[model samples]
Target chain A: MVKSKSWTMVKHFEGLPKLEDFKLEEKELPPLKDGELLLESVFLSVDPYMRPYSKRMMKPGDVMIGSQVARVVESKNPAFEVGTYHVTNVGWTTHFISDGAGFQSLPKEWPENLPRSLAVGAAGMPGYTAYFGLLEICNPKEGEVVLVNCAAGAVGSLVGQIAKIKGCKVVGSAGSDDKVTYLKEIGFDEAFNYKTVNSLEEALKNASPEGYDCYFENVGGNYADVALQQMKQFGRISVCGAISLYNDSVPATGPYIQTYMLFKQLRMEGFLVTRWMQRYPEAQKHLLKWIAEGKLKYHEHVTNGFENMPAGFIGMLTGENIGKAVIKV
Target chain B: MVKSKSWTMVKHFEGLPKLEDFKLEEKELPPLKDGELLLESVFLSVDPYMRPYSKRMMKPGDVMIGSQVARVVESKNPAFEVGTYHVTNVGWTTHFISDGAGFQSLPKEWPENLPRSLAVGAAGMPGYTAYFGLLEICNPKEGEVVLVNCAAGAVGSLVGQIAKIKGCKVVGSAGSDDKVTYLKEIGFDEAFNYKTVNSLEEALKNASPEGYDCYFENVGGNYADVALQQMKQFGRISVCGAISLYNDSVPATGPYIQTYMLFKQLRMEGFLVTRWMQRYPEAQKHLLKWIAEGKLKYHEHVTNGFENMPAGFIGMLTGENIGKAVIKV
Candidate 1:
């Protein structure tokens, strides 16, 4: 029998999700069937999308749905061998029975001596999200100005670096001075701490004199509106996520932006990475190549132990995590 | 000698625009030099973008700028002969002198079947605006749900029809019952009069069950918020214009859609059609071909008399005109 400790949703939230909403449950795993394998969770990803999506998709009394990097310990399935690393969206469980489905076996030919935790991060889904979102949707051209928020984080960091590789001037906005410094270190031409800024519009105008050509939006609210006022005549905005108001008790009712969009004639689009899942491998190939060439870098804030998953998740929602927030099991 | 009368801006409006804001002045004819060609205005194209952009780009007491199709009545240059038509950004002038290099010349090949007024309306900027804005920015795929506000107007009408041609189910929202009917008649899968609807979200929920994949937003405020909530995963929003909140004195707000963009992982883009000026011929060729094949249709809300251009503009702002608002000077 495989021993497992799982974080199950014991309650739901109205505003900011609380730790009490989750319960630490202990369970015994059954023996692997002929086609099944026993896997141990090595890492768990805690993302902002899960919070709102859980309120709608997942219910109370269920293991939180999330992606993880795991190692197969024992297997009746020949495809998943012992000590093999695989990436799966298997939620917060410590051990799971796998039937060799919904799991991608890590390639043996990956860059020599790469960390396995990144299989759930930069070299994985979020990296591909930034790749397809910026290149395909935003279509930033050479000499164009590209701005991305959460600049030091997983997706934003990759987005800025990718734009830099494409020969575009990259600008980024993060929550702290350290994060802002981190963004510059990663090749961003301009980076600002939104927290220290008096006005987002003023900050943007001060940074980009001709206005931003393309914006990869991850943070919403006043920040988006501020960027809106400083866009070029024909700008493109890729709306990947709005982290600012994910846990809002009320709705956003500040200055409206629809008029500005029409006046500037800007284009804004939102995307789910799954929309390009068919082209996932293509994105991964480009991203990994960049990584190998030292053109792309990623950071993960790993919260030690499976018991700290909820704290890791809440910290990410509050913009506390520096990069991709993960719970190391 | 060329005689001309042009409307100059007399004052800025505090609220509703009046006749005093503009003053029509006739200037005595100046003899055309060797390189000058005298032109008479035949058609004037009026649009919403001029309202706010003028406040920034144009100073008070300057001539109100607009585009018109003018006939070269007399010319001292060999480059332009009599009976040739040219489109000029010559403002509210009845007659002017051009050097033939300043304005775009309209070809005289197909004058019999096509309307000359189309040079300032459908065959010109607004038509191409609808074409590129809908196709390039939105990029709607087959079986996708497309929502267009101001569906009976020039750009939105074409957007709905083109979306239909692209195999997307289109829903349109208009301000009046007549416009709603017109939208339905123009191949819109569903059309609703927003004026009669009690709640925008409810109407959207009723019209789009599977959720919207592309939204061509012309009217903003509550309408935009409602449409945003209805967007599916990875939805695309093309912000063309916002006629709804243009005249408001206070900052606009409603629906609080910041969280929705992130939740749906939505993408909204705003674009000025003029950004594709270098590619105008490409879009024009496609639009003309669509017209030739009867795949596209358009309407012009013509207001005759040059002196009454302000009246038509005010009416269009109040949502009275259905289609491309223009003045037959």
Candidate 2:
């Protein structure tokens, strides 16, 4: 019998998620099935979408859902060999059994010096989400303006950079000066600390005076509405997430923009990276190439130990992470 | 001097527009310049979009903005021969002076059998809007389900028909029983009076067990939010207009849909027909062909005399018109 640790949702969150809402427990694996491979949790990813989707897609007693990069220590499936790294949707567990079907086998050609934790950060869901979401949905053209919110976070940071790669003028909104500086360092043409900004519309207009042609909306609420107004005709909005109103104590309102979209002729699309899972390897190929070329930069705010998953998730919710928030065991 | 009567906005309205809010003015037109043409209104089209844009885009004292099919009475511009028909952005005025740039000669292939008033309704902006907005943004795949609100209106009617032509199941929501029946008679898969439906969600669910794959949103507010929840994963929403909340005395408050869009991976795009004017000829090509092939149909709720423009506008807003509302002069 193998002992593994897992975090389970103990209670629903009303506002900010507390450490008490999650409880960690130890379990013993009975045995691996014929097609299942035993993965030893190495790094866990804490993302904002998990906060809302857990309340939606999971029962209270169910294990908290998330993704992690793990090493295949023992395998019943021939496709996954021992000592190979893989990205799997095994949740907040220290050990998990996954079939080769949905699990991705990370390339062994990856530079040995590069952190393997990036498999969940820049090179994993966050990276591909930014890549495909911007390239596919935003469909950015050269000289076009691309605006990203939460630009310091996991997905938004990469979104801005990728839009730049596609020959777009990238503008970003972050919560802090450090993140804004980091965004500027990463080739974002314009970056603002939305926390200090008095008016969202003024800040957005200042950053993008000509108006944004493509808006990557990871932050919803007032920021989105202001951005909606500043969009040029036929502009595209890629709605990856809405972190602002996820844990509201009461239903939220404002940015009253349902009508503006029609007059401005804007397009806002929400996407899940899984929608492009079929072409995930294709995305990884380009991402890996970008990393190899030093054209892509990834930052990780890792919380050490399995018991700290809640803290990591809470940290991410509060915008404590620079690029991607990860839990390392 | 030429005597021509016109309707001018006396003041902005508080709720539904009333006749008292407009002032009737008989103006003497000055002589046309050497390069200008004199136009006399023949047919006028009333649409819902004018209601909202007027408050923001128009000042306290400006000629009412609308498209009109007019006949040139006298011309110095060679393009406009006297007695020639043209579509001009000539507002609500009975007469106006324009150079060649203000008008386009009515297409020779234009159906003489069809009412010339349709050039402003079914075969004009509303018709072209439904064609492009639905096909391009919604992109309904075969066997997918499509839903449209205000289905008896000019834009909504055409949206439902286009979805049907694309081999998708079509459902529509109307404000009254007669319009509901008319939607079914025109071959809607399901048509319901939203006013009579006890629960919009239940009605939509019962109507779309498989879930709506494409939504042509003309009505905003709770109706859109409820329809949004019923959308299938990867659904597409074309934000054509929001007629439901157009006349609201106050702003609308409802559940925020940005979160739902992310989970469902839905795509919502807003569009105006003018953005595609570079391809305007193509719209005429497709809409005219569809009409000739009997794959498409048109309805006009004609009210005689131009004096009723305000009443016509209000009637259109209140959903009194079964289809396109036209004021025949």
Candidate 3:
């Protein structure tokens, strides 16, 4: 028998999540039955989605939901072998037993030097998110201006780089000067620290006076209100996240969008990455190829231990991470 | 020379327009040159759009912009014959000289018994607005549920009927009990008076417990906020007008929509009827055929005489009209 450690939510989050809101629990795992594999979580993901999703999908005392890259420690299943790595959504646990039903084994050709944590970061869910959200919804055309907020975060970072690959002029904003510098290094044509800017509207205008043709929206609320007005005629908006508004106990109020949408003939769509579940492999292939070619870059903010998972998640929500936030178990 | 009488805006409207904000002016028109035709306004349209458009497209002393069914009183242009009627966007003037370049002549097969005013109502811009806005943006599939507000007005009435023709279940809401009755008479599966409903949320829930698959939004602000919440997963919204917000001196504030939109994976697009300008004839043909087959119906709120044009426009903005509001000059 092996001991398993997991985190559970003490209560639904009211605003930003805090350390006290989580409780660490330990339990003894039973012997694995035939066809079952014992897996140890190597790296756990902490994302902005967990904040809003907690209110919608979790209850008090329930294990906090998430995904991880894990290694097969022992396997009785014929399809699996010991020491193979796979990505699994078994929540925030150090060890879990699975029948190998939904485990997604990492590609055999995964670059040897690359950290396996990326299976839950870029080249994984975030990569697929930026891939489909920007390409499918915004559909950026060559030479068009594309704007993305939270530009140094996992999804937004990839969104800007992908629009660049498609021949678009990419403009992005992040919360800190360092993140803005990182964005500039990653080939973003324009990058601004939204927190330091005197006015978001002027910052956006200075970046692209011709106005945006495609807006990959990650920060909603006042940022969205101003950004929406700058869309050129027939601009497309792909709403991937509303991190700024997610913490509000009540929904925020802002200027009605219908007038701008009408005059500009804008099309706005909201989507979840899971909507294209069947096409994940296709996105993963492209993401891998780009990384191998040095055309795509990824950064990770890895918290050293499973014990710091709550702090890492809280820090991520507060925008402390420049890229994917993950915990090493 | 013909003396033309027209109404001009005294100044930009601050809120709901007042009678003192308009001034009647008279001007003499020049003799027709070769290729020019003298036309007399027969019937003019007064629509909700005029309220907002006046601010964007007009200034003090400028004649209010509008479209009219006009008779060719005299013609130096060989393509147009005296006594033939055509639709022209020559604003509020009773008489004007045009080069016949952009005039659209009434269909040769137009039913003789129908009033020529229908050229500016059911067979004109409002009809095309409904035809394309709902069909193109919402794209209601057969057996899906559709919800439309302002259900007894020109575009809304047609939108509901067209959804039914497409084999979808339709629910509609109007401001008055009489308008609600009119919606029921037009074959709406469910109809309600929004003004009298205890709660818009309950009203929408009771009308269609399954939630709406398509929403045709004409009235925005609070109505849109409530209606957006009632949309089912993957629902589409066609934003045609925002009559509720048009009169506000400042844009109204409302609950942000991105959260609901994300969870439902909704698509919302705003459009003007002119977006489908080249396809107007296609829409008009279908509208005429449906009316001739008695599958479509039209009602006009005719405000008599040219002098009442401003009053007709104001009344329509105030929701006094049951259907297309027109001034018979």
Candidate 4:
């Protein structure tokens, strides 16, 4: 028998998730059955989506819902041989027994120089989301202005970089001055710290006076309303996430955007990354190529140890992380 | 010289528009120039769009912005000869001198049985808005559930019928019980008076137990928020208007819809009829064919006389009109 350490939801979050909401527990795993593998978590991802999704989809005593990069320590399954790496929906467990279901093996030709943690961070779910959401939904054209909020984080960071690669004039908004500088360094034509900016409308006006053609929305609420107003006619908005409102106990209210959307003929679409599961490899391939070409950059804000999962998750929710937040197990 | 009677915006609207906001005046038209034509108004359209668009795009003393069907009384341009009928942006006017620019002549092979006034109503901009917004944007599929608000009005009425023709289950909401009955008579699978319903959410849940696949949004604000919650994953919303909130001096607050949209992977697009200008004839041909086959029906709530333009427009905005609202001058 092998002992596994896991974080389980002890209580549903009320406002911003508290450390007491999650409990670290140990479980004993039996020997792997035929077609089953024993895996050890290498890196665990903490994303903003977990905050709301946990409340909606999970219950108390359930393993905290998440994705992780794991290495097969022992295997009875022929499909997943021992010593292979995988990206799996294995929750926040340090060890798991799986039948290789809901898990994707690390690409066979993954660049040797790339870090293994990237299997759950950049070049993973967040990267794939930014790739498809921006290209498929927004379809930014050359010389067109593109705006992204939560600009220093995992998905938004990649979105701005990808827009730049597509020859778009990219503008981004982050929460801190440091993030703004980082976003500017990563090819954003203009980056503003939304927290310090007196008005997002003025920041947007100063950034792109002509108006944005495409908006990759991560921060919804008032920011989205302001962005919608500044959008050029027939603009497109890819609604990826609403990190700003994730922890709100009460629903936030702002200017009714449908008015601006109608007069401007704007298209705003919300999407989940899994919608493009069939085309995952397509995005992964392009993302890998971009990374190899030095056209895309990634950053990981990793919390060390499996016991620190709750801390990592809480920190990510409060915007303490600069990029993809992960717990190194 | 001809004396042209026109309504000009005397002051900006405060709450609901009043007769005092407009002034009826007469102007002397100069002799027709080489490219000019003289038009006698036959039918004037009163629409919900003019309520907000006028405030944003027009100035005091400007002619109340509108579209009208007119008979060409005299013409110096060969493209438009005397006796031809045209739909032009001549505003609320009894007679006007136009340069023949931005004017479209009535279909050359228009059926004699169809009223020429339809050139600005059912078979006009409203019809085209419903066509492209529904077919191109929402793309309702066979057996899909489609929900349209303001279902007895011009665009919403047409949207429900079109969705039915596409083999979708159509549900609609209107303000009055009479309007709801009219919607059901026109092939809606279910109809409800939103004002009578205990809760819009409960109404929607009862109407579409499986959840809506397409939403034709004519009434924005709270109605939109309720509809967004009941939309199935990957649902589409074609936003045509926001008649509900058009008259509000203060923007009403509702549930921030981005939360539901993201969870459902829903797509909501706002549109103007002009977006489909290139494909106008295609939609017009289809609409005309449907009308001839009796698959599509249109009702015009017309207030006779040019002086009733304000009344007709106000009535349409307040949900008093059953279908396409127009004025016969």
* Model 2 misplaced stretches (Cα beyond 4 Å): A30-37, A76-78, B30-36, B75-78, B248-250
lDDT of 2 by residue, A1-329 (tens): 88999999997777888999899999998799898888898999999989888888888868899988899989998888899998888789999777877777678887787888888888888998999999999999999999999999999989988888788999999999999999998889999999899888898889878998998988787677678889998899888888988988675777345687788878888988888889888888888778778778778898998888899899999998899999998
Number of residue pairs clashing in candidate 2, backbone atoms closer than 3 angstroms, sequence gap of 3 or more or interchain: 0
For candidate 4, list the clashing residue pairs, or say none: none
Cα deviation of A214, candidate 4, in Å: 1.5
Model 3, residue B278: what's the lDDT? 95
Clashes of 3: 0
Candidate number of the best TM-score: 3
TM-score of 3: 0.99
**Alpha carbon deviation, residue A326, candidate 1 (Å):** 2.5
- Shift in Å, residue A72, candidate 3: 1.3
- Misplaced by over 4 Å in model 4 are none
Q: What C-alpha lDDT, on a 0 to 100 scale, does residue B126 get in candidate 2?
A: 87
For each candidate, report its DockQ versus the true two-chain complex. 0.57, 0.69, 0.87, 0.85
Ranking by DockQ: 3, 4, 2, 1
Question: lDDT tens digits, residues B1-329, model 3?
Answer: 79999999999998999888989999999988899999999999988888889999988999999999999999999999999999999899899999887888898777987888888888899999999999999999999999999999999999999999999999999999999999999899999999999999999999999999999999989999999999999999998998888989878999888888888999999998898999999998999889888888999999999999888888988899998999999
DockQ-best of 2 and 3? 3
Model 1 C-alpha lDDT per residue in residues A1-329, reported as the tens digit of each score: 66888888886676788899889988898877899989899988888778777878787898888888899899899887899889988789899897978777778776766677777778888888899989988899999999999887778999999999999999899999889988888889999998899877878877788899999988877788778778887788887888776677677677778777776767676677887888888887888888888998778898998988999888888778777888898
The lowest-lDDT stretch of 10 consecutive residues in candidate 1 chain B is B254-263
Model 3 chain A poorest ten-residue lDDT run: A101-110
Which docking category, incorrect, acceptable, medium or high, applies to candidate 3? high
